[model samples]
Each structure stands twice: as C-alpha cells, then as structure tokens.
Target: MQSGLTRDRLIAILMLLPSIILVAIFVYGFIAWTGYTSLTDSNALQQLSGLPAQFIGLKNYNDLFTGGLNLRFRIDMVNTVFFTVMFILVCLAVGMGLAILLDQKIKGEAIFRTIFLFPMALSFVVTGVVWKWLFNPTSGFNVLPTILGLPAGQFRWFISEERWWPFAWQDVPLILSILFLGIAIFAALWYWSKRRSQTAALLAALALLLLAWITFGNPRSLSGLNPERPEAHGFNVALIAIVIAAGWQMSGYTMAMYLAGLRGISEELREAARVDGCNELGVYRHVVFPLLAPITLSAMIILGHISLKIFDLVYTMGGGDNLYIDMPGINMFFTTFRSNQFGQGAAIAMLMLIMVAIVIVPYLASQLRSETKL
Candidate 1:
C-alpha cells in the first residue's frame, strides 16, 4: 500500500511538471536569467552613454545603491518604496471606505459601484493614455484658470519649478491662495467627492491643488524669477500620473473585495460589538477589522505585488523618451534593448521580482498560519 501511494504521488508530481516547467520558464527562469545579467556589464545587450559593458559583478548594484549618471536607479529604488507604501495605503483606505459606504443599502449603489469598478477592465496602457490627455498642462484642468478669466498663463501645474512644497504652517498661506484663485476648482472637487468613489475625490482634489500651486504658489509666475536649481524633469511627473491612474483603477477592485469580506462577516458579531458598547466606528475598528484581517492581508498582498510590478502603466502613460526612461525601471528594460545589454535588463526585472517576493511571501505565510489556527 505504501509503495502504491508513493507511485501515485510521483505520478501526480509528474502530471503537474508541465505547468511547473512553464512557470519556471516564464517567471522564475526569466528572473534567474535577469539576475545573472545584473552581475555582468554585458554591453552586448544595449548601449547608452557610450559605456561599454563588461563583467562587473555587483558593480551595477553598487552604483544602483550609490549613484549613477542620472542618479535614477537610486531615486527609483526610493520611489519604488514610496510608491508601494502610498499605493497600498491609499487603495486600502479609499477602497475599504467606499466598500463600507456603498454596502449601506444605499439606492443606486450598483450603478455607482459599477461606475467606480469599470476602470479595472482597462489595461495600464489605456489608463496612462487617458491620463496623459487629462493631465496635459495646456489643455487640461491646468488651463481652467486662464479659461475662466483668471490671469493668462497664471497656472503652471506640473511645469513650474519655483513652487513645490510648503515647508511649514506659515507657508500654508501660499498653498491656500494657489488653491482659491483657480476658478471652478472647488466646484469640480465638490462634484467629484459628492459621489462615493474615492478616485473621483482624489483626482478632483489633486486638480484643485495643482491648479492653485501653478497659479499662485510659483515664484516664477509671481515675478520673472529664474530657477536657482534646474527644473524637476525626467519621468517623475509620469510616475506620479501612473500612480494616480493605477490607484484609481485598483481601488474599485479592492472595494469589491472588502465588500465581499464584509458580507462574509456574521451580522451577530456586529450586534455583539454594539452590545459591548461599541459604536459603529468602534465596531468596525475593533471587531470588523480583526475578523477581516485575513481578507485585508490578502488584498494588501495583491496590491503590493501589483505596485511592485507596475511597468505597463508607467511605460505607456508618458515619459517614454530616452531622456525620461533615464529614470530607472521604466528605462532599465529599454536600456537592455537599446544597448543590447539583455543581461542588465534581465537583472532589473529580477530585482523587481525580488521586491515583489519580499512583500508577499511573509504576509502569505502569516495568513496561512492564521487560517490554520482558525
């Protein structure tokens, strides 16, 4: 009987070997190849800046952590972390909040839900294209100030360098004047936020803020002030755009997941929480959230992985020029193709794979452990 069972297990493994091989080839194998490439200065893959490639083990990685010409690799590593954290938090907050709100027996909830979720069906490439048009400095909400009889060329939005961050509470006056001067900014925000969709709210808020900053905040606009530092360029704006667009798209799906998880929860638990002196917020915070931890963890892993591997949206949205791809991940693959440094490109791909793994594996293990205990 033992021998027969062993034979059966081997047969099952053999049956599954094809799929396993497929995954290895497409996913794990590709990553391994890329890792090998990163260790080499393989100029045969692609060439840029006339830098000939040779076997430079860990040199590229060192430069990546240190600095390169554009300082892009290092910047991008930081951006990746920042982007991942922000994306996960924003998507969870917006999605989970909307899920709760829409689940509250509201009328026309399905229609509203569908409207919010429709963006998920789109490819990242499509999302980027649409956002590019919407974010176009001259033609988009950036120009709304001028169109509404505000000063001509008053708003710089994404283009101006003089106005960036508000350092403190006192500097907030600058942020607010820039906010109020842009015509219809508040109106647009109100319209978007009145609905339950977080994407609409976020977009509207950004539009207003960017409008205000460009119109009132920029020193260049206030006077003929030349930039002391060079204007911020590269794919930073494009990355920002991609994050916003992708976050908007993903939020709806997250909302759906949370909604399902909420429904799965027993009504008695909520009532019990109330009897225990918990209000609605308290019940959600203390009871619902704890019960929903598994689902939330699952959702977080998905979003985290998605954020790490988010290439198509970043690639297609904007900043495709050689000057722009200089920003790291967006260009890393292109660099391999252009310079024929397939190995280096592969290495970048592998690095991204590692990042995704780092985020997901431990979370999944914990989730499984929790489920087993339950």
Candidate 2:
C-alpha cells in the first residue's frame, strides 16, 4: 500500500512539472533577462538579436538622477509623485463617502450602486477619450459656462502650462520647518493623551514660533539648481482634470470594497456605540472608521500600484507631448520603442518594479504572518 501511494504522488508531481517549468521560464526568466539588459549600454534595436552587449553597471541610473540630458526623467518623476499621491487620496475619500451613503440602506440602492460602478466597466482608453473631449479648452464642455450666462471659462485642461503654489526647490529649509510643525502637532497629541498637557502646550507654542520665523523672517527667494532660473515650477494644475477622470473611473471599485468592509461589521457594535452616547458622526469617526482600517490599507495599495504604472489613460488623454502630465510609463514606452533607447527604458522599468515592490511586499508579508498565526 505504501509503495502504491508513493507511485501515485510521483505521477501527480510529473503531471504538474510542465506547468511549473513554463512559469519559471516565461515569467521569472524574462524578468531576470530584463534586469541584465538594464545593466548594459544596450541602446541598439539590433541588440534584440542576442548580439554582444557592453556592461556599464549603474551609469544609466546615475544619468537618470543627475545627468543634464535626462531632464525629462526628473520632471516625469515629479509628475508621477504628484499624480499618484493626489489620485490615491481623492479615490479613497470619494469611495469612502459613497460607501457610507450606500450603507445607510437608502432607496434604489441597487440602481445607485450600478450607476456608480458603471464607469469601472469601461476601459481606460474609453475613459480617456471621453474626458479628452469633455475637457477641450476652447470647445466641448468649456462652452457650458457661456451657455449658462457665466463668463467664458478659459481653463485649458491638459494643455495648460500654468502651475500653482510655485516654490523654488532650494526652499528645503522652509519645507523642513513646515514638516517640523506637523511633527510637533502629532507629538503634542501624544503627550496630551498621556496626561502631559503642559508639555503638549509647549510643543505647540514652539511649532507656531518656528512656522512664523520661516514665513516672515526669511526674505531671500529660494532657487533651484540653475541659479539663472531662480523661480521654480510648482504643481501642474493640468493634472486636476486627469485626476478627476481617473477617480471617476476607479472610485466605484473602491466603493464596492469599502461597502463590503462596512457590511462585515456587526450591527450590534454600532448600536452599542450609539447607546453609549455616541452620535452618528461620532460613531463613524471613532468606531466605524477604525473598523475599516484594513479595507483602507488594501485599497491604498491597489490604487497606489495602479497609479504608479498608469499608462493608457494618460497617453490617450494628455498625449505624448504634454510634459506637464508626463508619467514614467509613457516615458518608458517612448524611450524603448520610439527612441530606441533600450538601456534607459529598462532602467525605468526596474525602478518602477522596485517602487511597486516597496509598497506591496511588506503588506503581503504581514498578511501572510497573520494567516499563519490564525
């Protein structure tokens, strides 16, 4: 009997071997090849024929960070940070709001849910095309305000070159002061919670003083690396339109996730909080929101990864020439296929992979450990 069982197990292993081998070769093998290509001076398209390539170590990465010729990469890096942060925050807030409303068991709940989720069914290409027409500066949706007897709107959506909240990159001292103030606020809260009111008050006072000095005492203008162009660029307002379109498409998915989380919470717990003198707002703020932490974290990770790798939507909507709305994915596509610069493109790809892994791997490890404990 033991020998028969051993033979059956061996047969099962043999049956699965092909699939395992295929995955290892196609998925991980290609990833290794890409990493290897990124370490070389492999710009020629003919290099795809397995010709000898020159290994240049980290020169490509260094060029991306500090090379004068790689200004587009640096600008795209800024755009990516702004786009991802705003996209994630807006999606989370909108999704949570919609989920909370739907959880109230309102009338026509199914109809409302369908209406909200319908956008998610459409592809990013479709979403981008529709938004592009809607945001056309001189035409499309811009004419609505004039039709309504309002002043003709001059907003240029994605084509606008203007930036807001402009500040020089050399203003690191001012930025640090603001960040210190934020830290002081959190420290004050911690101290107050520990019944150290005096210490909390002192911290708050110092933070205010530091903020005032940074704002009023400093008279010199902050500058960038190029001293000739002292005025630094700020957030591109053009991205607001893109964020709106993307958020409209993805908020429904987040709403569905948050709704599921809300439904999983026991009703009795909410009722108990209410009975304990918590109002509707208090219950949501204190009890319900805390319960939804896991859902929020999951949504953030999913949306963050999507934002980091976003390509089709921005490409279709903003086009390739708009530097204000450029992203790494678009840059990578142009660099590899359009410009025939495979080495730089592969470097960008590796950096994107590292960024995504940084955000997701830790969360996944923690989840696995929790499952193990359970």
Candidate 3:
C-alpha cells in the first residue's frame, strides 16, 4: 500500500512539473529578470557589462522620480491613472447599456451584434489606424462635415488650436453620455409617473425646472474642443480617440457575456418578482442585476486590464508620437527605448504593472467574496 501511494504521488508531481516549469520561465522568471534590469543602468544597443550591473538599490527608481524631466516620471504616473480610470468607467457604462439594448428582442439582432463585435475581432492596431483616418483633419472627418454643408473650415476640426475646440468634440460626447445617464434614469421615472398619474403633473414641472437649471449651470463647451493651450491639444485628442474606439470595440463582447449571464437566470425568479408587484424597472434592478453581478464584475476587470495595457490602438492612431505628448506609461516606454535606456524602459513597465495590480487585486477580492456568498 505504501509503495503504491508513493508511485501515485510521484506520477502526480511529474504531471504538474511542466506547467510549473513554464510559469517559472515565462512568468516569475521574466518578472525577476526585469526587476533586476530596473535596478541597473542598462542601455538598449549594448548593455555595458564592465560597468557592473549589480544591485544599485532603488537608485534607478529615485532617478526616475527626481532625476530629470526627460523621464517625465511624475507626469507619466498622473496620466496613467487619469486615462485608466476614465476609460474603464466609460467602457463599462457604454458596454452595459449596449448589452441591455441588445437584450431586448430587437430585429436584425445578429447583424447589429456582429457590427459591434467587428472591431474586437481585429487587433487594436487595425482599429487605431481606421480611427486616425476618420479623425484626421485634412482628409478625414473634418472634410466630411464641411462637404456636407455644415460650415466652412469645420473639416480641419481635429487639428484646430484656436476656438475650434478639437478635443472637446471628441471627449465631450462620452463624458456627457456618462453624465446624462445618471440623470436620465430619474428623468425617465419621473416622466413615466407623470404620464401615468395626472396628480404628479406638478412633480414633472419641478423635474423639468431642475434639468434646465442644471444644464445651464454647466458650461456648454465640449471639454475636448478646448485648445486653450498648445501643449494640451495632441495628447488630449489621442486619449479621447483611443477611449472612444476601444469602448465601442469591446462593448460587443461585454454585451455577449451579459446576455449569457442573463440567460442563465431562471425565469422563475423574474416571475416571482412580477408576482410580488415589481414593475419592469424594479424587476431588473432588484432581481436581474443582483444575479448578474458575478459576470458584470468579470467584465469590469477585463475592461480595466485592457485600458491599462492599451498600446496598439494608441500606437496606430497617434503613431509613436502620442507617448511623447503626455502619456506617461506609453511615452516613457517609447522614449526610453528610443534613447537606448533599457533599464528605464523596464522600470516604466514595472510601474504600469504595479498600478494595474493595485486596481485588479481589490476588484478581484470583491468579486470572489461576492461569488462565495452567492
């Protein structure tokens, strides 16, 4: 019996060995090697062996933060956070909304679904190039609007530095969409109540007054359109473009996942809600959303990860220049690589890894907890 047990244990270990080897080689091994490189002052073309690539402690890290503006270290960190947060939020909201809309028994559902998923099928490189052309001032979207008889010189809209507010045009719609949705749910409810009950006419009047007041309180100008300063124009444009394109591309996949989650939900729960006097909105809010939480959390994590590592889209859309403008995570890598600063480039990669981990760990913990309870 003892001999037989030993044989079984040995066989199990042998079977697991290859996966462990691969993880050590590709995962932990690369991470340790990169961490070592980050501590040294290595260059791209030729790593100076004679100079001793030994442990320099956090010297490289210190230099990165306080050494020179060439590093643009602080700026890069700020940009990474800013871009990641905004992109994740926008993608989640838009994707979920698309999922809900497609969930309805709409006509030509397959065609519409395919159109949405088409961008995700291609690599980000392809999507970026297409968007760049569509957004280009000279022969792109600017030309179309002007040719369509909107006005003179509106075609150069993307590049305009004056009152043209190029970035505003790009970023505003998404921001406004996000902002509007929060208000719209209540607005929709208010409208429904007013229509159903004549006694609630006064409440509808109050809601309209509130909406108009809020609208006027905020600036009418699109945030992306403002080119008050030269330094802001290019990066802003690139960031907005990338976010919109990515959000649109990934939305279909999110929708499909959500639809699957929705399908897995038994009809009996919804029927119970209906029997309990829950309306359509109430059923979705109380029953459907709670059951779908696990899938939604998964989608959120994927969206966040994609935003953090986004490269090809920005690369193709803005070329290598986007990094230089103000994108720290991207710009740092490009600049370091260009300057033959291999150590610094590795450090930048490490920084991005840390930031992404910060986001993902907490998110995953919450997801696991929720799932365990369910």
lDDT (Cα atoms) of all candidates against the true structure? 0.67, 0.86, 0.66
Q: Model 2, poorest ten-residue lDDT window?
A: 219-228
- The TM-score of predicted model 3 comes to 0.70
What local lDDT score does residue 60 receive in model 2, on the 0 to 100 scale?
Answer: 85
Q: lDDT (0-100) at residue 88 of candidate 2? A: 95
What are the runs in model 2 whose C-alpha is more than 4 Å off?
1-16, 45-51, 167-233
Per-candidate alpha-carbon RMSD to the true structure: 13.8, 5.8, 11.2
User: lDDT tens string, model 1, 1-374?
Assistant: 36655877999999999999999899878667677778887776236566665677876665454333524554465456556777888889899999899879799998999988999999888887787666666676666677778854443332333322313222334445664545345655666667745755665677767765665665343322223433232223334545677788899988999899888888899999999999999999998888878777888899988877777776665443523322356757665767565655666666777788898889878878989999
Q: Which structure among the candidates has the greatest TM-score?
A: 2
| Ranking 1 against 3 by TM-score, winner | 3
lDDT of 3 by residue, 171-271 (tens): 43344554665565566577676685543454456556556645564433333233353222223334555566777678778878887887777889999
CA lDDT of 157 in candidate 3? 27
For all predicted structures, in order, the TM-scores are 0.70, 0.82, 0.70
